[model samples]
Target: MTKDLYARHRSVLPDWLALYYEDPLEITHGEGRHVWDSAGNKYLDFFGGILTTMTAHALPEVTKAVSEQAGRIIHSSTLYLNRPMVELAERIAHVSGIPDARVFFTTSGTEANDTALLLATAHRRSNTILAMRNSYHGRSFSSVGITGNRGWSPTSLSPLQTLYVHGGVRTRGPYAHLDDRDFIDACVADLLDLLGHTRPPAALIAEPVQGVGGFTSPPDGLYAAFREVLHERGILWIADEVQTGWGRTGDHFWGWQAHGRSGPPDIVTFAKGIGNGMSVGGVIARAEIMNCLDANSISTFGGTQVTMAAGLANLNHLLEHDLQGNARRVGGLLIERLRAVAAQVPHVREVRGRGLMIGVELTRPGTDEAAPEVASAVLEEARAGGLLVGKGGGHSTSVLRIAPPMSLTVAEAEEGAAILERALRSI
Candidate 1:
């Protein structure tokens, strides 16, 4: 049955939409941190549908909220005032850390980013954008143009002239060997030099942690350093928190807070996990920038009553239950155990990341060469052990990404780590 479905999927879906493992999975249902397949085999869910499921699966609060809202109405268009949408916006705006903030909802992270780009360009009156190297924003045409990773981007042609900046990844770069302070200095120097040769940029978009680039990140305060430079020139700083927002990183409620020495970013965009798989995303900025458009703008299906209802329940549950505290506690233990396992394996190049968003990079046994095949084999073995993980990286997809729901428990973390240890051992 799985084989038949895989064949049909290949025929019907776009080839670029990738799937994991030698034999793909068909998850029938989920509860807590585990899911089941058609064969009744249960497995640990570490990826959380690409970290979209912020809370546990089949969570009563979110499910109940979704069902109740569905019974009433789904879409009423943006023409009418939406109570749930207004409430959620109020909650997000208060917590966004932006002064006089405004909120605009979207259906996905891509659209949210598209909205950000639109606002930045219109406000600054420039088609030039500054983007970080090895970043993955989204799949929209405008988002793709700003992305610096060739592996994820499909075409070279773009609507905006993007200047790629350094310091997104702390390892594998020319300045990797430098200390944190020196690295920041070197990157800032490079940025100033780049600015000398380019047109004025509308904004600089970056992920607090490079999600698709193997969960790598620069040292703390790197962005703060950049913010100082950009602020001097009146350039805006936009933090793409699609994967790193809402306490997924553990130490902070928002990823931008890590670099808060200089204050918050100019604009913030988020999507994944906000609705716990309900397709809710949004952009937050000061009223001046958000309202800089000459004409009115609205999203028809962006903040439907149903999605907003789910979002409200999910956000309240996440905060009230203290999931971010759980992530900090459990994710710390998981990363330590995985590091111990990786130490015994020579091919496991590096174990990096904080909280639940960890990455284990694989390489040839004695060389620095990336071993994508070894990464693939480890993924299959891990699945065979009843554990599900994810893969991503800038060097040919050689990093294993481990991001469970923020509500992961200590016992579940230990269990998942044990299964992952066995999988890494086999490789």
Candidate 2:
């Protein structure tokens, strides 16, 4: 029956959809950081389901909240008030430390980002958006329009007014090997030039850490300086924290906080960890930016009750357990171990990133080209040794990204890194 179902679905699904299964493992259930295949084989989750399960799978509190809320209500219209929705928004605003943040929830990160992109344009009445090269924002037309990668858009480029690229180098910092001051100056100059060439920019969108762009970390004070430029030009700084936020980075509650900005972003997007594994996403914009909203901007089923319940429970779990601190301590240990492993393995080119959101880059001998195949081999070997990993790179599949749940223990991280080292050795 399962095989028949898969065959029927494959017949109708688009080729470009990129289904993961040639002979897919039918996953039936998950708990904590472990998932069980239909055959009962369990996999220790290191990738955290693409960094979405911050609290791990089937969290007790989160599940209870969902079950309880399901009995009372599942969804409601935006025209009416719901308790969970109100509470979740309030919690997010308080934790974010963004004064007077007005949130609009959506069912997925892409939709949340879609609203943010439109909000930026509406508030500034401008079309040009400054973005980073190799950044992955979302898959929607406008979100993909601002994103710098061809992979996100198989379709032709959208005719937006302006698109600028920055930061695609091997060295540390946003612009690769540039000091914070020089990188900030160059990026600011680029933004000014783009603004002068086109009309004023609607927004300057960026991730706190570039997730899909090989886990790029911006230069320190980069966002602050860029924010100043955008503020001067009456443009919004849209911090796309889809992958970097929700305490996955470890040190900060949100990715923007790690950047050391004096004021929060004019707009910020959150998903993934917002509701554990549920499809809940949202944009938190300042009251000033949200003032631009009109009748047409509202979503029909964005902030449903079920999503709010899940979000609230996830936030509670994060706070009660102090998962952010765990992320910091455990992730630090993991990074140090990964660096040590890199030193031992010639193929492991570099180990970088903050807290739990770490990456080990690989490259072949004599060539600057990334050895993504080597990275893939490492992944397979790690899986053989009982671990799962995610891959990323611009040149090759050079990056082995380690974005485990905040719930991952220090001992678990050590075990995972040890397995990784063993895998590299086997290769």
TM-score per candidate, chains pooled = 0.99, 0.93
Deviation of model 1 at 152, angstroms: 0.6
> Which segments of candidate 2 are over 4 A away from where they belong?
1-9, 19-23, 168-175
C-alpha lDDT values of all predictions: 0.92, 0.78
Any idea what lDDT model 1 has?
0.92
Considering only N, C-alpha and C atoms within 3 Å, which residue pairs clash in candidate 1? none
lDDT of 1 by residue, 169-281 (tens): 88888998999899999999999999999988999999999898889888899899999999998899999999999898999988889988999888999998999989999
Cα error, residue 53 of model 1, in Å, equals 0.6
Q: Tens digit of lDDT per residue, candidate 2, span 1-427?
A: 5587577867998767653323444568888877776667777777887888888889988898889988998877677888888999898888776668898888788888888888898888877888876777788877778776666656656756547656434364356566767877777787677677777778878888878767867666777877887777788888888888877787787788865565788899988878888888998988988778776555567778887888899888888898888888999999999888788777877788887899888888555567877887787777767787788765545788888888998778888888988988876
Candidate 1 regions with alpha-carbon error over 4 angstroms: none
**What TM-score, to 2 decimals, does candidate 2 have?**
0.93
